[model samples]
Target: MEAHGPHADDDLVTMLTRTGERVPHPDFDRYAEDLDAATLRRMWHDMTVVRGFDNEATSLQRQGELGLWVQSLGQEAAQIGSGHALNGNDFVFPSYREHGVALTRGVDLPEILRIFRGLQHGAWDPEAHRFHLYTLVIGAHSLHATGYAMAMDRDGLVGTGDPARDGAVVCYFGDGATSQGDVNEAMVFAAVHDAPVVFFVQNNQFAISEPVTRQSRVPLAQRGAGFGIPAVRVDGNDVVACYAVTRWALERARSGGGPVLIEAFTYRMGAHTTSDDPTRYRTRADESYWAERDPIARLDAYLSSLGELGDDAREAVAAEVKELGRRTRETVRSWEVPAVASMFEHVYAEPHATVDAERAWFERYERSFAEQGVHA
Candidate 1:
């Protein structure tokens, strides 16, 4: 598949160029006009920190400290920008690779690694953070998010005119997930019910080894329009555009507008996961093309031009990034194996004869290891 860089399309909503130049948008520029140098600097810090965290996770996976890792490497701007636009009460349902979104939601970085380290089913409280546990099943959470949005609407959360009480839902999934039946069904239900939801599709150009071209002949943004929902495509590498577009979509959803779809045109820039090999299916030339539009670098350049990110600010951010990597490494290494019996504890609300018997057998099997002077 031929690579389509951000500059190739004029229709893409954008506020920043590949070379980090700030540009104006007729419709969307007003949304970002309120963003001063301070806000932009904060955004730069966020994107830089998350990218550092993502890189640390990748390294951990390679070092065998983590069983697996999914990177948000090149797509940091799409996540961090949209994440910053969310209201505190708004809920987010994310796929497994949404580490940047997790960071923005105040989820403890180490807690996110617990699942990948095989220590727990889920480590954080979804209610506390308003960020649901990462869904590993492809496209399943789209239905979950839609159902939640319907519930929110029924509970008088929609069109309330009260910003504090009104809220919307954000459902994030990858380009590959667009092909799933569940995603289509979710969109259908969301549109029919006029649910207050924003379907955030990060179109990272590839679904693992399969190119998006093989999946659809038309732009993915049209899928939302087909369901009678408003849709917009943004240059996913442009942080300002992402923030503006997401804010617009969320406002519509919160104030009685139905479901909206945002197709973030971006690239993955790495393997789909630690288990996949991009080198097998994609060429290095394609990787290099996206690298020029690297979101963090682009934002850095823009911030530098405005004199918002100088040597001092860069040094501070670097220190923070270094500390984050150190903390993550320490935390992952210090994790102790949870008791084996803990798994059986949450299998059911009430004790069952079958579960009891299985637990008893497992305990006996575990004791067998102790008898043989081996760790179970």
Candidate 2:
């Protein structure tokens, strides 16, 4: 399945309306129908908790507890929904702003915090959580995902008829990442080889300061068509839609349907990172417009309509989010920085002489900062 131009017959208008207007239609209903009361509640809880974690991390960066922070304040549903759609065996390759996805994939929050706090390259083993380390090199992870899918295919990890073993790889990236050569290359490989992977693009409508329209002449999904991947656009802020579409694609891949591309229409509510100020590039009206169609708020409306959300539930979730924030702040504050010598440990399995010598010199230089009369 490769990318193609949007078809007049493919319901693009309906998909866009579902995402932008929050309309209730057959496609939206089909996706929403699977959300049981318990699952809906859980989704709400997870979103609230992750949002709290996001805000606290941003604050920590500002307060000097973290070197930097990537806020996912507005993209929680896009991440969390897709994450929850994965089976345990599915592999996830993520870009840096996927804290919600990492949380859903069971990566310890504190460990993810450790990376930004400058304590480790990454805190969790990728294999352990089926979640790769956060890739900061823009679209590079898409290549890794393509390779992983190829390996899975070679290993006969598809069409086993056993859903658990027949897992696919999912790589998450942003609208900006689509412009990268690595991403394009990955798409080419995935489509040509028919690898079992899903390219989940969270098109938050801006790449730093560039609007999404500037990045693509057509819709992003159409980009996949040229590469021979079946593509779909979904309401990223609608958790139900995100989960349903992702699950559908994953099931297809696992069952030997090859690759698919999903463009999650979303918005980035905060700065690109703590160091950025979106106000300098984007207008307040743009922010306000997206904020009104917030994923959480939309979910809240759906839940309320179903009689699943109430004052008690709302207050309880809010309190839990606050507690999550408090715990994250406390945990981050308590973590000890790694020893200066530990930096050389993971460079390679065997010690390299040059690295050892460099480490020794670094230790000496570090100790000088603690020595008396070192004010200069």
Candidate 3:
């Protein structure tokens, strides 16, 4: 009940236990109670596919096909759960590492690789999917999300009592980003203006090498409560709990309630990125503790209990997962880098004098390299 406690998990909202047992939360269980066996199975499939794609991406990075890769190894349930809860009109602003969210938004999985492969500035149309391009500059997108939500309010998109017309925005960031000023400021603005945004924080236990403990002595969810916004912490590895909590938050925001903050108590099983070495800072014991709570496995177990995910179904899923990995590998390897001159494009919505000047300079530099019979 105490959001400011040292033990953050003590008040976690959970619908499924680590052993796949269904548990009841007096408040949130109602939100997830309607999920039947089929929906549960689909969630498991989503997590499995996302994990498979994530593994392939990490392998691609290791093989030097990608400049960098971020693994969502242990955070699948949190992403998939929240992703499933979104309405078609609800927009998503994700910090990089949200492959599950991208899949749920119907984004072509290969398109996500374009940025890491250094092929494009942004690979997908934001307006098309309502899923913005990944923002890697820390917590900057929280402000962007908040501003967008305020604009939505001005346009009469919130609290219309029309499920089809009302919309909300969900901004995905991490526990580490909670320490950033932009995230805090965004919360302040959202609370003041009652912006229809849900700030979902995936507390994967570390900011690169720094542990969550180093960032906050109390629960990260409490930060929202301090800003006069409602906050909830959920068992991130439990897919049902995550889906239910996000639905609760989204409903609140879409219906004119202020922003909500959700702290998903999950772990990042792999390195922060392909460029990071988590082993240098975290222990095997830490990894093992979370491994037992693997989100995909937990959901699979729950589905199995309902007689939904039998061995035959698993084999089918395995084949699909394998094909996904194969396609990802093939597509990434087949990509040709874009023209260096193309970098000047999309620097701004419209052409600027400075960008034009820089493009001209680059062109001249390339010509000099051509004259010398060398590549630029």
True-structure Cα RMSD, model 3 = 2.1
- For lDDT, the strongest prediction is 1
1 or 2: which has the higher TM-score? Answer: 1
- Number of colliding residue pairs in each model: 0, 11, 0
Cα deviation of 288 in candidate 1 (Å)? 1.5
Q: Tens digits of per-residue lDDT for model 2 on 170-285?
A: 99999999999999999999998989999999988778888776777677888888998999888678787788888889988898888999998778999998888898888888
lDDT of 1 by residue, 273-373 (tens): 99998999888888888899999999999888887788999899899999999999999999999888888886787888999999999999999999999
Q: For model 1, where is the 10-residue window of minimal lDDT?
A: 1-10
**Position 119, candidate 1: lDDT:** 87
Q: How many angstroms is residue 288 displaced in model 3 relative to the true structure, after the best TM-score fit? A: 1.3
* Model 2 error, position 224 (Å): 0.5
Q: How do these models rank on TM-score, best leading? A: 3, 1, 2
Rank all candidate structures by their lDDT, best first, as comma-separated numbers.
Answer: 1, 3, 2
**lDDT of each prediction vs. the true structure?**
0.91, 0.83, 0.90
Q: What does candidate 2 score on TM?
A: 0.89
Q: State TM-scores per candidate.
A: 0.94, 0.89, 0.96
